[model samples]
Every structure is written in structure tokens, then in C-alpha cells.
Target: MPAIVVERLSKTYFTYKRPPGVWSAVKSLFRRERHEIQAVRDISFTIEEGELVGFLGPNGAGKTTTLKMLSGIIFPTSGAARVLGYVPWERHAEMQRQIALVMGQKMQLWWDLPPYESYLLLKALYEVPDDAFEKRVHELAEMLEIRHVLHTQVRRLSLGERMKCELLAALLHRPRVLFLDEPTIGLDVVSQKRIREFLREYNQRERTTILLTSHYMQDVQELAQRVLIIHHGQLIFDDTLRALVERYSPSKALHLRLEQPADAETLSRFGRIVRMDGLEAVLEVPRELVSRVASEILQSLPVYDITIEEVDIDEIIRDIFAGKREAGALVNTAGS
Candidate 1:
């Protein structure tokens, strides 16, 4: 069975509108003009059990809103959604116990108390057995390497440590489904890597269905096998990361270190030069012609070392959002 099923799910927010004037404000007391904002448009998708999917988008793209609906935090304006075979908005106890939601910016742990104390509260709330709770807490804390600080106050913990503790809390119940919103946000590179490694291992061992939303491309690149991209409150792409790069990126990058200095004019014959600095140059060439162009450059130019690179995922996503590339075709092709 699918872990999640969303069909034509959408959320519209209604807010009062008023002109910037004292007279307009006074006149709006009895009657006010209301404006409709589509936070999430008609979007539909399914997530199978044990799949780790990446949810990607820029600011205000409805990524969090969709997560909220899936986690039963908010109600949708239209359509339907089921999480773990239960209507999420209905907030069934069984479904609630089987799923976990963690947002990096929000803290469910108390600030002044130690994390262990918070764990006690959560254990009671989740109705976890005593022996199971003890085993899970220590295991997660040891894996996250936060065991030494579990007794320390949460406010005294570093940002990375707090995030780890958050993960420990979320996983204490052994939830079958996990929803993470920017779980690595504001964390340093080392902390980010550790968390990613831990998540990858945990997913493999537990077969947990995870849906993660993050701005950091490395998080998606290293951890997600499939990606779902939302733009302007709509899902523009839904496919594997490799498929996304293959379909949307038309060119490959070539990095060259020359044995002799070559001017930009000399390199222009081979491909569009992305950067030219001293004897090192970067070029963008058509994907289909990369082999031919590289061969010609080796035969013609004074080349010391050359390497081919796929277009950066970050650049491709930026182009899609900046209107440098058309995503309408992608939506049509992906049946979004």
C-alpha cells in the first residue's frame, strides 16, 4: 500500500484587504474586502512505503503547506489526502502514532529542561513501553552522538546538537512515516553530513517512509533517490534526480587545465566558455557533443588535464525558477 495518497489537494487562505488609509480602515470595520491566496494549488502525488523522497522549492512555494496538510497540522481548502491509510485531517490516534513530523525551526522540547525530561513526556504521550523507550532513546542518542549532552539543558545545546535531539525525539516511537522540513537548516557542513549519514542508515535499517524538504541541494543530492519539485504553488516536476538532470539540463560542463595559456578567443571554437582564468578554463558544451568536443580539444589545444562534469543541480533549479528555462513542458511531460 502507498504510504501517502494525495489527490487534487489544495489550500486557499482568505485574508482581509484594506487600502493604506485611516478612512479605509474605519470603513472596513463592518464590511471588509477579502482576498484569496492559493498557498497550495491542485497538486496530487503518491509516495510508496519505505521510499525517501525529496520535496524541493523556493520560498513560498507551498512545500511546507503541503507537509502541514500531510501531517494533519492544517486542513486543505479542497480535495483529499490519506496518510498511512487514514485521513490525515481526521487526526486518528493510530495514524498519529505511526507518523512523525519534525520542523527544524520549531522546537517541541522545553527550553529550560533537559532533553531526557522531554523524552519522558513524549514517552507518556506516545504510550511507549518502559523498556522500549529506554532502548530507543539510548540507541538514537548514541547514533546521533548526543548522549553526553542528553542530560544538559536544551537551551545550552548548540544548534546541531538540538537538531539531533529533535531527531531522537521524533524517532523514539519508531514511527513508520517521517516528515522532515529543513531538518538540516542552519547546521554546519560537518553536522549536515553526520545527520545525512545517520538518516540514510536509519532509513535502510528501519525501512521508514521519509519525505524531506530542504533548500540545501547536498541534502537532496546525497540522500534522496527521488525528487518532487514545487514552484509557484504547483508541482512542476516529479521524477528521479537523474531523470531531472537528464531532461532539464541540455549541456555538460568541461573543466580544463592547460599546459599553456590560451586566450578566450582560442577556446570559443570548441564551446561556450563559462570561465577563463589564466591557464584554467571552464566550458559548457552540448551534452550529445561532449565527447567530440573533448576529443577535438585534446587534439588541438595544449591540454594538461581535462574533466567532464554534469550541470550542477543547483543551477538547473535556479534556471527553472528564474524563467531561464521553461517548466511548462516538464509539467506536461510529468503529468503534474
Candidate 2:
């Protein structure tokens, strides 16, 4: 069975918009006004066991709201969701025992105490055996290279160290399904790479199913093969990373190194010049015309070397989100 099955799961919130003035607030005391905001709109998808799926969207795209619903933190307004054969919204103990949720901005560990104490607290809460708890903590600390800082207070640790400790706390019970929302939000490049490597290794060794949401495209590119893209609270694309690039990206980049200097005017005839320097130029050409343009440039210009490559994944996805490119449903099933 799929680790997660969500069918038309949606959450709508009712909030009121009031004026800033105190007089307006007093006037509205007798008559209250409210507005409806559709946070998630009938979005549906499924994730199979052991699959690492990236959930992507812009701000206020309902990514966090959806995660909250799936993690049983908040009840959905309508539709159904099941994680590990149990309804997540029902908040069953057995189901809770097998799933974990980690939010980058939120803290589950005690601020004044060291991570060791928090781990012990979680171990007790989960009813983990004493011996098993020790073994698991040691193993995770070593894997995350955080053994040195495990005894340090949570408030004293660096951002990366705190994030690692958060992961350790969430995984102490060895949950089968993991929900990670912006796990590497503000970390540096090196820190982000470390977390990704640890998560990848853990997923492989334990066959854990993970659903990750992040604004950083590198996180998705490095970890997930399948992706679910949400836009304006709607599911827009669901497919492999390769398929997404192929279906939505319309152009390829052609980089050329000329034996002699080339002027911008001369390069413009070949294709759209994205960048130009003394003897090097980068051109953007339609996918179908890339080969033809490359051949013409080689024959017509004093070219030393030329390489054709697809557009960067981050740029392609950005254009899609900005509505510069239209990407229709690339898969028949919403989730596979």
C-alpha cells in the first residue's frame, strides 16, 4: 500500500479583515465581518512506500497548510487523507507512532536544555526501550556528525547544529513516514549539502517515506526524483524531474568559445545572446532549433568549441511558477 494517500484534501480558513482605527474596531463589535480564504483547494496525490517526494510551491501556495493537515496538526476542511492505512486527521496513536513531522521554523526541543535531555524526554514520551533509545541516539548523532554538540544547550548551537538536533529528536522513534517542511531554509550551502546527504543515506538504509517541502530548488534537485508542484493552492504538475524539465522548458542553452573575438551583432543572427565576452558567448535557442543553430554557428563563425545544454532546472521552474510558461498535466494519474 502507498505510504500516503490523499484524495481531494482541502482546507479553508475563515478570517476577518478589520480597519486599523480603534473606532472602526469598536463600531464592528456589534456587527462582526469575516472573509473566507481557500488555503488548499481540492489537492490530491499519493506517495508510495520508500519514495522521496518533493512538495513545491510559492509562498501562501498552501504547502504548509497541506503538511499540517497530513501531519494531523490541523483538521482539513473536506476530503480524505490516509497515512499508513490510518486516517491522519483521526490522530490515532498507532498512526502517530509511525509518522514524524519536522518544521524548520518550529522547535520541539527545550530551549534551555541540551539536546541530550530533549532526546531523553522524547524517548520516554514514545515509550522507547532504554537500551534501544541509547543505541538510536548514538547512531543518529554519529551519522549527523553532531556527537560533539549533543551536550550543548539548544540555544547555543549553530543553525545547522540545531537543525541536525531537530532531526535527531524527530527520528528517535524511527518513524516510517517523515514530513519535512523547509528542512534547510536558512542554512549555508555546505550545511544544506550535509543535511541532504544524511537524509538520503537514512532513507536508503531505512526505506523511509519522506515528503519534503522547500523553496530551495537545490534541495529538490538533489533529493527527490518525483515532484508535486502546487500553484495558488492547486496541484499543477506531478512527474519525474526529467519529465518536468522536458515538458515545460522550451529552450536550451548553447555556449560557444570562438577562436577570435565575436561582436554582439554577429552573434545575434545565430540566436538570442544571453551573455557575451571577449571570445565566449552564451545563446538561447528553441529546443527544436538548437541543433540547427549550433550547426550554423559552427560553420559561419570562428568557433573553437561549442556545447549545448538544457536550461537550468531552477530557472525553468521559476518561469513556470511566474506564468511565463504553460505546463499542462504531464501525467495521467495525479500520483503514482
Clashes of each: 0, 0
Candidate 1 global CA lDDT score: 0.93
TM-score of every prediction relative to native? 0.91, 0.90
RMSD of 2: 2.7
Off by over 4 Å in 2: 20-27, 260-278, 288-303, 328-336
| Cα lDDT tens digits for candidate 1, 171-226 | 99999999999999999999999999999999999999999999999999999998
- Residues 129-196, candidate 2: write the lDDT tens digits: 99999999999999999999999999999999999999999999999999999999999999999999
**CA lDDT, candidate 2, residue 302:** 91
lDDT of 2 at 202: 96
Top TM-score model: 1
Worst 10 residues of 1 by lDDT: 327-336
TM-score of 1: 0.91
